[model samples]
Target: MHAHGGTRSGDAVPGDEELLARLRAAPVLAGPLPEFDPAAAPDSPGPLFAAWLTDALEAGVPEPQTMTLSTADADGEPSARVLILRGIDSADCAFVFASDARARKGRDLAANARAALTWYWPAHGRQIRMAGPVTALGEDAVRRDFLGRSEAARAAAFTGTVSEPLTGTQEYDRAFRAARALVAAEPDRVPDTHTVYRLRAREAEFFQGRADPFHTRVRYVREGRAWTRTLLWP
Candidate 1:
C-alpha cells in the first residue's frame, strides 16, 4: 500500500484487481493538447507527418524523433525496437533509419521487405503509424551516415556481431576497446555491415486522443502517385 524510502511509488506492485484499478485511475490526455483539424490536413501524409513532428518538437517532447520500428521474420514472427529517426528522405518521402545489416531486424527486412513505424508523443496525445515496404539505401548513403555519427557511435558500430550471444562482459569490453582504437586510427572507417534503410509508407494514420472520448483519426492511402485521405470513426 505504501512505498519505502529509495523506492519509487511505481515500484509497488499491486494485486490483479488493484493493478486494473490503478490503471483505470491513471490520467490520460490530461493536456493542453494541440488541436488537429483533419479537414485542413495536407494532401499527402508526408507534409502532415512533418507538421506533427514539428509540433512535438516545439512542445518539448523528449526524443520526439524516436519511433518504434516493427519488422517480421520470414516466418511472420514480429519484432519491434525503439530507434532514433535518421532524417526522412525528401525526394521519395520515405522514413529513414539505420542498423547493422546482420542484426535480427535487418535480416527480417531482408526476408520480408515490409515493415511499420509508430510514433507516440503522449504529451501531445498524438500517435502516428506508417506501414509499407522497406528498401536499403546505397552504399554511399550508408557510408555518409555512418561517418557522420559520433566517435562512440562509430566505435559501437564497429563492434559487429549484433544479436549474437555474448560470452561475458569481458568479451564485450575487449571487442569495444579494439573497435574504439580502430575508430581512432581510421576516423573515416565504416563497418561493412552498417546499412541505411528507407520505409515507403503505403498507408499512414494519424490519431489524436481527446479526453471527451471523441478521438480523431485520419488515414492516408497511396493511390498511384497520389494519396487519398479518409476520416475514420473513432
Candidate 2:
C-alpha cells in the first residue's frame, strides 16, 4: 500500500530528484485573483501599497503587515529577516520598524544606512518591495515606540545584548523573569538600546501575479519631488 519513493508505509523518503519534481508541480497563483490595471495605479506607490495591504487584510491573509527586511553589513554582506511593519510615514512614504541597536540588523544599518523591505501576501497574489536609505528616528519617537509595546515585549527588550550566542536557557529565563518583575514595577521604563528607524523609499515596486503567464509589475521611482511609474516585463 506504499509508493516506491514517497513517504508512506514502508516507503523510503523522497530523494532529491523526486523532491525537485514535486516542488515543480506545486500549485501557484491558482486562485480567483483580482484584476490590476497599471494605468489606474496611484501616482505614488505608497497609496497603492496601502490599497494592496487593505485588500490582503480583507482577504484574510495571515500576518499581512509582516515584511522581509534586508540589510547589508559594512563588508557588503547581505542578510534578511521577517518582522512586523510598525508604521508608515505618510508625508515621505517611509516605512517604520523598531529594533534593538545591538542587534545584527541595527549594526548592518549603521554601517550601510540603506535597507530593503519586501512584503508578500501569497493568498492575494501580491508583492511590494521598497528600498532606500534608513535613518533612526529621534529619541522621542524611539521612546514612544518602546513604551507602546506590551509588558512582555518590554521585558524581552530589557534583556538586551541581542544577537549574542546564548549560553543557556536558564540564564536567559532568569534575566527575563527579573526584567518582567522590573517592568511590572515600573511600566514606563524603556530600554536604551531600543530604537525606531524609518526607510525613506527611493523606489517602490508592486507586483501582481496572474494565473496565466503574464504577470504584472509596476515600478515607481522618485525623482526630486515627483514620482515616475513604469511597467516592467514579467
Candidate 3:
C-alpha cells in the first residue's frame, strides 16, 4: 500500500496516493453561499465579519464561532488547534480567546507574540482569516472570564497543566472533582495562570466560495486608524 514503492517497517501501509484519492472524492463546499460583492463590502473587515457571522447564525451553522488558532514556538515551529471564539471587538480591532498560561500555547506565545486565527463556515462556503501580534489581557479580565465558566471548565482551568502526561483518567477525575469542590466553596478561585489573549489583527481576509473555481477573496490591511482593502485572485 506504500505509494512510494518502498517498504514501511514491516507490512506496507496505505500511502499518499490512496489518501489523496479519498480527499479528492470528498465533497467541496456543498452548501449555498450568499453573493459576495467585493466592492460593496465594508471598508473594514470587522463589519464584514459581523455581517457574515450574523448570516451564519441565522442559517444555523453549527459552532459558527469556532475557529482554528495557530501559534508558533520561539524556534518557529508552528502548531494549531480548535478553540471557540470568545468575542470579536471591532472597536478594539482584536479577536479574543482564553487559554491556560501554563499550557504549551501559552509558552509559545510568551516566546512569540504573534499568531493567526481562522474561521470556516462550510455550511455557507465562507471563511475568515486574521493574523497579527498578540496581547495578554489584564488580570481583571482573565478573572471574569474564568469565573464565568461552568464548574467543570473552572475545575479544568484551575488545573492548567494540559500537555503533561497523566497517570490515567482516574487520576484526572479525582483531581477534577477535588478542584470542583474547592471552586464550589470559593467561586472566585481564578487561577493565576488563566489568561485571555487578544490578537490585534494587522490584517484580515474574507473568503467567499463560488460555483466556479474562481472564488472571491478580499483582504483588509490595517493602516493606523484606517484600513486598506485589496481583492485577490482566486
Candidate 4:
C-alpha cells in the first residue's frame, strides 16, 4: 500500500520505511510495574549517583562524565552547553571546568548562581538531572588545576581568545602565540578568564529506562537546609 504523503506519481518516499521501522521498534508499556523500592535506594542522592556512575563505567559507556549544564542570565536569557563533570562531593553536587569571566555561561553564573546539569547515558538508558547554586573556585584552585594540565592543554588556556568569533586559521595561530607569550612572561599569574565553578545541588532526579512500560524516577529535594528523597511516577 502507498504510504501517507505519497506523490501523485505513486513513488514511495525515501525515508518512510526507516521511519516506520523506528516507530514499530519503539518500547511499549503494557505490563506490571517494575519492583523499585524507594527505601532500597541510597538515602542520599550523591551516593546513588556514584553507584549509577559506576554502572555506566562498567558498562563501557563513552564519556561517562559528559553532562549538559544549563544556566541563565539575570535578564532571564537561558543558555546551555555541554561541559565535563570534574568532581563531586557530599557537600556540593558537581564541579565543571569553566572560566568565570570568559564566556556567556560564566557571566550568567556570576549574575545568577542557579544552574542545572543533565547527564544522559544512552547505552545504559539512564539519565540524571541536577539543579543547584554555583560557586566559583578561588585562584589557588584554578592554578593547581592548571599546573596539573599538560603543556599543550595549558597552552590552549593561554590563548586568551575565548567565545570570540574567529575568521581563519592564521588569526587563531596569531592569538595563540600572543597568549603563550603572556604566559611565558608571568607563569604564576592566573588568567582572569580561567576559573572553575562548582554546583551545590539542592535537588536531583535519577531516571532509569526499562524495557517494560513503567520507567523509574526518583527525586531528591532540599528542604529547610536538609535533603528529602521521594519517588515519582514516570
Candidate 5:
C-alpha cells in the first residue's frame, strides 16, 4: 500500500517535520584525490579489494560483502537486487548467490553476460563498483556450496520461486511441506534451482570518503587480458 498520501502516479514529498534532528553528522569528502597513488594501490583489483575489505571489517562495517547485482533482460529491461558475495577469486573475480531455473536474473545472465555489482558501506564512507561479463559455474561447484548451507537455510531456499507472485499463506505452506518432505527423502541431493554465477569483472571502481574535502576514486579497466588503472576526477 502507498503511504504518506502518495498516489499511483504522483507522491507527496516529505517536509521539514519528517527530517531527523541530529546533533552531529558524519563529514563527506570532496575535492581531489589524496596523496595515495592508485597505480601503487595493488597489483590487481582483487588484492586491492581484499585490503580495503579488511579495513572495512576492522572498522566494523556490517555485511561488507553485501552488494547489489544488476542485470538486464533480452529486451533491455533492467532489474537489480541485493545478493551476498559468496566468494572472491584470486583474479579479483567474485561470485553471488542465485537460482538458475527461477528465471529473471538467471535468464538475463544466460542471454547477456554483461552485469554490474555495487558495494557500499555508508558508515565507513566506502564504495566499490564492479562491472563485467558473468559466467555460470559447474553443477558440482553449485552443489558443493549448497550442501554446505545449514538445513534450515537449504529448506528456506526451496520455499519460494524467485520473482514469482505468491498466492497466499496456504499455498506457501503446502509448498514448504512438499519441499521439506523431498529434502527428507533425499538429503544428499542439492536443489536443482540453487545456483551461483561468477562475475568476471572487466572494470572496477573504488571510492573512499574522508573527513576532508578530498575524496578518492580509482578506476580499473581491463584491456584485452590486461588491466589498466587510472584515477578519476571525484
Candidate 6:
C-alpha cells in the first residue's frame, strides 16, 4: 500500500516478506564479550555499572549517557524514547532523569510508577537493563537540575509542552526566542513544571555477549538494603 501522501512510482522499498526473511537470516550477538562471574560480582550492580560506564567511555562509545527509557501507560501500553541519564544517586539504588511535567513520559510516569531503562554499548558488546519504581524529586533538586542544563535546554524546558505536534518550525522558533530573552533578562527564572524523576531499581541485570551461542547474564535483585546475585542461562 502507498503511504498517506501517496507513493511515487520510483520510490520502491523492501516488502514485509523480504524484511522478515532478512531478520530471520541475520546473526544474533555476533560480537566479542568479556567474562562474567556471578560469584565474583558485587552484591549490588551499582558499582559494577559505574565501572562498566567508565569502560564504555574509555572505549569511545558515542552517547554513553544516552539510554532507552521505557514506560507503560495506565492500560499497560508501552512507549519508549531515548534520553540522557541525569545521574546515579549517592546510594546507587536509583538513577535519575529530567523531563517537562506536561510531557508524555511524565504522564506515563504519573499513571504507572514503574519504568525501565536500558543501555547498550555495541563496541564493548555489553548491555545493562534496570527496572523498578519511580518517584519525583523535591522542588529544590528539580530547580537545580533545570538550571544546570545548557541555555538551549533550559529554554526548551521552559516551553513545558512535550510530545505534542507543533504548528510549525516558526512557532517553536518564536517560543525559543522568547524564552531566550526571558532567561537573559532574569537569569534565575525557573519554570515550575520542570521536573526530575528517580527510578529506584528493584532488579538490575548485566549482559555480556559472548562469541559462542551461550552468553553470560548476571542479575541482581534488591532485598531490603542488601542485594542477591544470580547467574542466568544464556
Q: Each candidate's lDDT (Cα)?
A: 0.89, 0.89, 0.87, 0.77, 0.76, 0.85
Per-residue error (Å), model 3, residue 167 = 2.1
lDDT of 4 by residue, 95-144 (tens): 55666466888788889989999998776667899998888888777887
TM-score per prediction, in order, is 0.92, 0.92, 0.90, 0.80, 0.82, 0.88
lDDT of candidate 2 vs native? 0.89
Question: Mind giving the per-residue lDDT tens digits that candidate 5 earns over 124-231?
Answer: 667889898888788887988788877766776788786789999998888888878777777877877777888888899988776564668898888876778888
Window of ten residues with lowest summed lDDT in model 4: 27-36
TM-score comparison, 1 vs 3, better candidate: 1
Candidate 5 residue-wise lDDT at 8? 53
Q: Scored by Cα lDDT, where does model 4 land?
A: 0.77
Q: How well does candidate 3 score on lDDT at residue 160? A: 29
**Candidate 1 or 5, higher lDDT?**
1
User: What tens digits encode model 1's per-residue C-alpha lDDT throughout 1-234?
Assistant: 344546555565668999899889999888777788999988899988888888889989999979999999999999999988997853345899999989999999999999999999999999999999998999899988999999999999878499988999999899999999999999988888888999999999999998787889999999989999999998
Pairs that collide in candidate 3 are none
Q: Which of candidates 3 and 5 is the stronger one according to TM-score?
A: 3
Mind giving the per-residue lDDT tens digits that candidate 3 earns over 15-53?
899979989999887656678989898878888888899
TM-score of 1: 0.92
Decide which is better by TM-score, 2 or 6. Answer: 2
> Model 3, stretches more than 4 Å misplaced?
1-20
Model 4, position 191: C-alpha lDDT score: 65
